[model samples]
Target: MKRFEDKRVLVTGGTRGVGAAIADAFAAEGAAVAVNGRSQQSVDRFLATRWGDFHGIPGAVGPRDACRAVVDAAVAALGGLDVLVANAGVFDELPFEQVTQEDFDRSMTVNLGGVFFCAQAALPALEESKGSIVATASDAGLISYAGAPAYSAAKGGVVSLVRSLAIGFAEVPVRVNCVCPGNVDTDMIREAGEASDDPAAYRAAAASRAPMRRMATPEEVAAAVLYLASDAAGFTTGVALPVDGGGVAGFD
Candidate 1:
């Protein structure tokens, strides 16, 4: 049988990029997936095209009420929940001198706050199913990235939060883990490259910086999420598994 046959899953910020890849992977593995996005339009667009089997739950993950609503909706739609992938986040690149209160708040709210509240809201259903949670952190969480301090801080919180939740949910027998990816080839990274004065040079520099000599694909990161959520990782919890091409192995 396929690995996740008959399972139910919810993936936050799943309309695009790595989240979308994770959602698609679950669906392909025979799981019923509910995908959450900030807007109904984006969710509808995704479902109407490549991911029709996925139920789209449109809402922001930052607010506690929204996270609760999204999780409730997913459970109702899928009949139960087996996995929750808290992957909604934003990234910014700016000098520390230019970092504003708005920047820091937005980073923490969407990245760290989203993961916390989403998992909290999903806890009851997860306990019932003895399910698992896989959060998308970043290599920046393990090691600092010069231009994006707020992002690094938020993801670092995610890494720590996974550990706490793993222990917190031990009695419930729910596993919690996280994936820390390095540079990835996604629209987010493409936009970052376009923002640079020398787009091609910026892209090249990013690839060269990774020990693998290239950025990771979203599918590659999704595979890690799959393992963490599957029976293959039944004994694993509270791990911040790195999918970073050894980028975090040494200082850059």
Candidate 2:
């Protein structure tokens, strides 16, 4: 159960949702976790009563300088970086043709560009520790989502970036992989529900679309990421693991 004992892990955007779950999981397993968020106040509020071994570094991952600063502080706090969960991302529903440049850029900046910057910043310490990197992508990255062009494209780019890192860092002893999730019941999902105007009905409709007739939990996705980042997945680099209540299994 303590597979991550003594490891130093970083979870970007760890203030909420899947990122918070990933940070909590690592801390539960004895890793020294750095919960990275955009605001110190928010991070402090999140850790107000949190248990286990963890620290906080407030920095937006989308900016290169901020990513480096956060990584540096995390490494200094934990003494090194053993694993990274690139879980910071944004989702929006926009028609492909109508998606504005701002929308596309925002998605790419926070999702794809943030992954690149944060992962790059963590690489040196990870290389030294011979650690692993797990990216949080989406099933939309694997399949087309009718009204999520920017989000889908950004996630797809994340998948590609993870693969490239896996191959590029093969000789560095650092593994890279991605977890593609589907309809996790997080606040983000709630926001989507509100956007649809009928929360319960929208949630039900989304759940029914999946074979399992239910959405996954953030913990489920975090568990998948932990597995991929653990020693148990030593040979699992470059894979896009789907933790989606079988939602992605039907993709052609």
Candidate 3:
């Protein structure tokens, strides 16, 4: 049998990139997945194809109210929840000097606050179902990334959040963990490259910077998320697993 057969899952930011891959992976493993995008239109588009039968829990997830709404909607649709993937986040790569208050807040709210509130909202369901949570953090949270100071701080909060939540939920059966990926080959990365004057050079430099000499695929990140959410990782909690192609290991 598939690992997640008959399980129920909710994936925030399920419209694209690593989020989409993680959603698809859960569905493929026989979970009744709930996909959450910022809007219904984006959710519909994501489910317009392979995820046609999956539930769409569309809503913006940053603050407490919105996260509660998404979790409530997903639980209502799925009857219960076996896993909650807090994968929704923003990537604003700005130098420390260039980052404005708005930019800093955006990263903190969406990247760190969303993960915190989403898990808080989902905790009861997870406890009842003896389920788990997998959040998408960043290797930037672990290592110093000079270009994205605010983003790094936000994700660093996530790394810490996972650890704290794991302990908080230990009285119950809920488990919490996070995956930290670096330089994923997703639209986010592509757009960052294309925004540069030399897109190819930008991509090349990103690839070369990783110790593995290539950016990780979304599917690779998805695999790490799935492992953490599955029963295979039942004993694991408060962990920050890096799926960063050795980027978190250290410089060459």
Candidate 4:
């Protein structure tokens, strides 16, 4: 049988980017996947283009109620929750002094709170199913960088919370972990490069920054997520796995 054969999975912010890749990986492994996008329209668009069919659980999950609702909908749609991939997060690149209240709140609400409340709400089902949670953290969480203080802090919270949650859920044996990805060649990065005054130079800089001299693919990150969620990682929990190309290890 496939690794996740007959398992039920839910991926938040699975409409595009890394989230979409993770959802696809689970579905390919024979898991029933419920994908959550910020809205029904985005979810419809994602499903329309994707070759693999997935259950759509659309909602903007940041607030406590919103997170609960999204999880509840996923459980209702998939009949149960075996793996919850908390991939919904907002990223911003701005000067710290210019950061506004709305920006900070939005970052915390989506990146940290989304994971917290979603996991809290999914605990009962996951405990019963002996399931797991794999979140999408970032290099910002592991190490410091300029231009995105708020996002980094929120993701840092995610990293710390994953460890704590893993310890707390040890008795239930419901694993909790996260992936800290470095520079990824996603649409968001492409857009940033395109918007820059020198797109090629910007892309080149991003590539050269990583020790491996190239940005990671969303699928690569998804692969790590799959590993953590699979039985292969049965002994793993509370790990902040770095999927980055040695970015977290050293600057080099």
Candidate 5:
């Protein structure tokens, strides 16, 4: 039998990028997966692919109501919840000097607050099943990144939040963890590069900065999520696993 046989999962931001890959991984492993996106259109497109056992759940994770709605829909559709992947997030570069209050609040609301409320919304079901939560943080959370102070701060909050949740849920014993990926090759990253004067050069520089000499594929990051959500990691909780190709090791 597949590792995730008979499991039910909900992945926020699952319509694209790292979330999409994580959703695919869960489905492939025999889980009934719910894919949440901001729009019904994007969710429908993903569901139309008929990839594994998937249901479309359309909602933005930024709002408290939407977070609860997504979880409620997932539970209704999938019968029960075995794992919650709080993967919805946005990214942008803004130097500390130029960072507006609006930009900072937006980043925190989506990146950190989204994860927090999503997990809270899924808490009852997870407690019932004693399941786990795996959030997508970033290497920026673990260390500093140039030109993305708001983004960095938001992710750093995610790491801390995961730890706190793990402790909070210890009585019920629901595990909470996060994955921190570095320089992933996704549409989000591509868009960032395109915003530069020379997209090609921008992309090249990003790849070169990684000690591994290449950006991580979304699949690679998904693999980490898979492990965290799996029974194989039953003993693991409150850990921030890095999938960053050694980029967080040191200055060198």
Candidate 6:
């Protein structure tokens, strides 16, 4: 049978990019997936074109009520939640000194806070199902980025928080882990790179900085998450899997 056959999966911010890739991967594995995004219209459009028994739930994961609502919607649609991929986050490129309190709050709310709330609300069902949770962290959480301090710090919190959950829930049979991806060719990274004074040069420099000599694709990172969510990673928990192409090898 397929690995995720009959599994019910929910992927936040799955309207595009990495989240979308993950949602698709699970569905391809025979999962009943719920795709979440801030835009109901986008969610509708996505569901209309996608195969498998997929549901579209629209809401921002940052808000506490919204977080609970997404879980509820997923359970309502798929009967129960077996896996949750917390892929909703914001990324902005600005100097540390230029980052306002508003910027910091927004970053934390979506990146770190959303993960915490979603996992917390999903814990009971997860415990019942012995399910898995995968949070989307960034290589920035393991290293440092010059222009994205807030983003880095928020992602770092994600890694730490999920690790704690892993240990706390060890006996509960709910596995919690994280995926720290490097520069992926998503619109987020592309826009950040292009925001520099020399957009073209910035993209080239960023691309060359990685040891692999190029950024990763969303599909590549999604595969790692899928593995963790499936029985393939049954023994894995509380670990931050780096899809960075050795970007953090020298940093630590």
What TM-scores do the predictions have?
Answer: 0.97, 0.96, 0.97, 0.97, 0.97, 0.97
**Model 2 alpha-carbon miss at residue 72, Å:** 1.2
lDDT of 4 at 136: 94
Q: Candidate 3's residue-wise lDDT over 31-144, tens digit each?
A: 999999999999888878873349988999998999999999999999999999999988877879989989988889899988999999988889899999999999988985
lDDT of 4 by residue, 111-203 (tens): 999999999999999999999999999999989668889999999999999999999998889999999998888877888788778989989
Alpha-carbon lDDT of model 6: 0.90
Residue pairs in clash, model 6:
none
TM-score of decoy 6: 0.97
User: Candidate 3: global Cα-lDDT?
Assistant: 0.90
lDDT of 2 by residue, 1-252 (tens): 589988999999899999999999888888999999889897998889697788989988887887889889999999999998999988898778888889988899999988999999999999999999999999989985888988998899999999999999988789999999988988888898899868899889777767888888899999999999998899889999988777878842
lDDT, each prediction: 0.94, 0.89, 0.90, 0.92, 0.92, 0.90
lDDT of 6 by residue, 119-200 (tens): 9888888888999999999998989688899999999999999899999998878999999998888888778767778878
lDDT of 2 at 249: 80
Per-residue error (Å), model 2, residue 186 = 0.1
Q: What's model 1's overall lDDT?
A: 0.94
lDDT tens digits by residue: candidate 1, 1-252: 989999999999999999999999999999999999999999998898774468999999887888899999999999989999999999999898899999989999999999999999999999999999999999999997889999999999999999999998977799999999998899888899999899899889888888888999999999999999999999999999999899988856
Tell how far residue 244 is off in model 6, in angstroms: 1.0
- Return the TM-score for candidate 3, rounded to 2 decimals: 0.97
Worst 10 residues of 2 by lDDT: 243-252
Which residue segments of model 4 deviate by more than 4 Å?
A: 51-53
**Which RMSD values do the candidates have, in order?**
1.1, 1.4, 1.1, 1.2, 1.0, 1.4
**Number of the candidate with higher TM-score, 2 or 6:** 6
Q: In terms of lDDT, which candidate is strongest? A: 1
